[model samples]
Target: MGTRKTKAPPPAALGRAGTEKDLPDHFKNYRHVWVFIELERGEVHPVSFELLGEGRRLADQLGVQLAGVVLGPPGDSTRRAVAEAFAYDADLVYLVEKPLLTDYRNESFTKALTDLVNTYKPEILLLGATTLGRDLAGSVATTLLTGLTADCTGLDVDADGSLAATRPTFGGSLLCTIYTLNCRPQMATVRPRVMRMPQRSNKPIGRVIRHDLRMLEDEIVTKVVGFLSDGQSENANLAYADVVVAGGLGLGAADNLQLLKNLAQTIGGDYGCSRPLVQKGWMAADRQIGQTGKTIRPKLYIAAGISGAVQHRVGVEGADLIVAINTDPNAPIFDFANIGVVADAVSFLPALTEVFIRRLAPGNHIRLVN
Candidate 1:
């Protein structure tokens, strides 16, 4: 079940021209929307593609160019990232290559990106809010002395061509939109899965603005010691699941979580809980779903006994469908839920799990024809 948007985003001047009365004139010439295309060891993180999808929209709204910025070592790794960027809707790619950038170092990356922004100014810059992205964005923003909004869930352009970065605030108590009114190259960071991935096309890359990184390996303070990969774990994957079943305080007891688990396992989905569940020791921190936890955009979400607070709402707002089951018809979850069931989850969850088990039994496969 997918939840509907119960409330629209807060409005403001909605345009830079309206809000930039006192803005410095020196920052006015910046143009184009740029997304940092992250590449490591010949692989590109999916979040970069997601940001390209979002950046494309802002670029269209502003009637400006959408470019992907790639900082990596020269070779197949960097070239692949640039090619994929074009396929994901980037009009052009900004390629800055150097041996020192072969691995992600806060100092080298920060210097390289900041130099690029200063040299060929862009109006807006976007980066994925991952480990490497967060570190690099912070350093670059600090160096450029521009305003930066982090962990943004939404991005848009206003009438006067400003980056409107929307993210949850006050510990996810509410949503807020922030703008860099007087700053050049407004910056923002978005977590993985927060934005939808764009469809890939055969459209070839138009142009590549190649730049040189003025740095030496010895100047970099931190060094990559070794490369180690963690074994695959379920907790790390709750955000990307196609289906998710989550329990909340409405369950009344920890044992009740089994009902949600049963339903998820039967459907080959993942199970999670609200923030309170983690505080109460009913679930692990990794299993919590919300702004402070993992942001999910599953195809279908089943929230049982969850109150659907603003914080939790921001995380799941991207789900294709949301089904809420709770006894309180007046709960906030009901306002946004696509399908609301008024019943005690403690009793109803078990019954629903039983029904699904029977219907999905082996040899009873459901099929659809296009």
Candidate 2:
């Protein structure tokens, strides 16, 4: 999500100054909250459901319906996506099916989504901040001439029924809440794993409103010639990993990162680093963890030699168990970590690694503590 040049109001005052009664006559007609279900390559992205979970809450608070908007070619994948949206608690879904939408093209998707918005007039619209979402969201918002808050970490409805979108700003040093006070269908995009997944219920599929794409194939400028997969199987899968072990500048040298790798390997988990390690060229960009990088929700996160800044905090706070190993007793990581160990990470990691190796050795017959 790209930053906006407009100055945002401080968090304390967001949504307090405006009421829906103050909206223009046309804007007042906007009602439900809609999440764009990202269907790509015959599958729906999980972030779409995550947004639906959040949309459910905002809809209930405003006494409005929560809906999912799906754009794709008509088939089992599209059908399954609609059902999954209902399972994720969407009250209804707006589906636009066409051959041109078989693969995502910016021109086709932007037109289909904008047409739906203009016709249905939802009060709030959300999309995942993925590659496709970011591309389409900018066009849709620009065409509608509305305000969009990108990469929002929090979503809420104020007493006045305005959308309160909170995101990190000033280089992740602070968070601010923005309200699209004057626009209809307040737009926001959230990254994957930023919101908790909603519980799925085995409900029969709910209402589905079908719409047509009015444009012809010749009207679109871009064409999907072919798709080549990146095929990087060894690429970091930190976002969905159950266990993550990461290092920071505290390790003192790039070579010491192998200590973290050894520990992660012994425990059967992925390894990563803080943003500084990436800047220092010690780790690849994809392995960086923080607001600018990946947001993780691991079951167990072990951080070594890192001072937890606000940027890094937002990424890993969702971890079920956070263990911090830093030499400084007052490192910011200690504030939220479940366990804090003040020691040289280079030395401590190898010792901890050996203990795990021994405990899990063949015929050890010892169950590790949960």
Candidate 3:
């Protein structure tokens, strides 16, 4: 038998220089970087701040201003979102407040954001890959007739000043970088927890460019009948958890998941699985962790029986500590994990659980026999 060799993907082509001589006359006027501050039900999504942190880096690289675009009804929530944007290091903010914009309607938000982009002409635009952000980004990009990359995991500026957006492709087997060479505003959407949150400060509010939305309420087709919220108890909230324990196919049987849950319960953490377990119908989709699922930044991550492919690695690389346990010493998980153990996860998990129970149980202490 012969081992199969995989072909490597070709390198991405470089984009044109960002100089005035290289860009089209119309695109030449585009300047600065803008991140849409997604506000829903009177609260700003944390993904907005994450994008701002990334936008700040791109802006510094391009030597341009970093701005936040806020569109919502005039209220305390809107005002607070603007202030928070400034605190997150936005050089300025573009405000569009109207009663019609109270609830996010695709028609209203698309009009407001497209109008802002047309008027101010930013060179780069970023949005969170949330439900609201996805709807608005698609509509705005379509209306503006520009290229838009969805669910990007990595974003950067090329030497030629093009927006380099990297995302998983071919069912998360490979990553490819995309560029909008001729587009005026290079647009991309990033999922929550994919980028690190920026440090915020109590800086005074900076320059705000207010723009009035001209569209009337009756002109919009979509109406908000009422708001229905999901059950809070059912929510996974996996991305924000302090500690996480995950398992993969090497666990051998679906029944073994209880080991993962037991460990997670012992540590006061959350438990999840890789994409395969979800595909196998052994785990819920929300419990899947990978490029196509939740991206986490937990303080500690324990991956048992996982091979640690690039897709899985990208999702948990933000963890402060990673401990991998697998029977195969050559498992890819060992390459990046902070600690690696070569052992059968089925047997190791129960022993690890017992050790924790002995050490962490209240008023339980064992004398050492040195």
CA lDDT of each prediction against the hidden true structure: 0.87, 0.90, 0.89
The residue-level lDDT of candidate 3 at 184 comes to 75
Q: Write the per-residue lDDT of candidate 3 for residues 253-292, one digit (tens) a residue.
A: 9999999999998988999999999999999998888887
lDDT value, candidate 2, whole model: 0.90
Which digits, one per residue and each the tens of the lDDT, describe model 2 over residues 205-283?
9899999899999999998899987466665778878899999999999999999999999998999999999999999
> How many Å off is the CA of 103 in candidate 1?
3.4
Clashing pairs in 2: none
Q: Estimate each model's TM-score.
A: 0.85, 0.91, 0.87
lDDT of 1 by residue, 91-166 (tens): 9998898888898999988988999899889999999988789899989998999989999988887776777888
Which regions of candidate 1 fall more than 4 Å away from where they truly are?
1-19, 22-25, 40-42, 226-230, 252-258, 344-347, 362-370
Indicate the worst ten consecutive residues by lDDT in candidate 1: 1-10
Off by over 4 Å in 2: 5-21, 226-232, 361-370
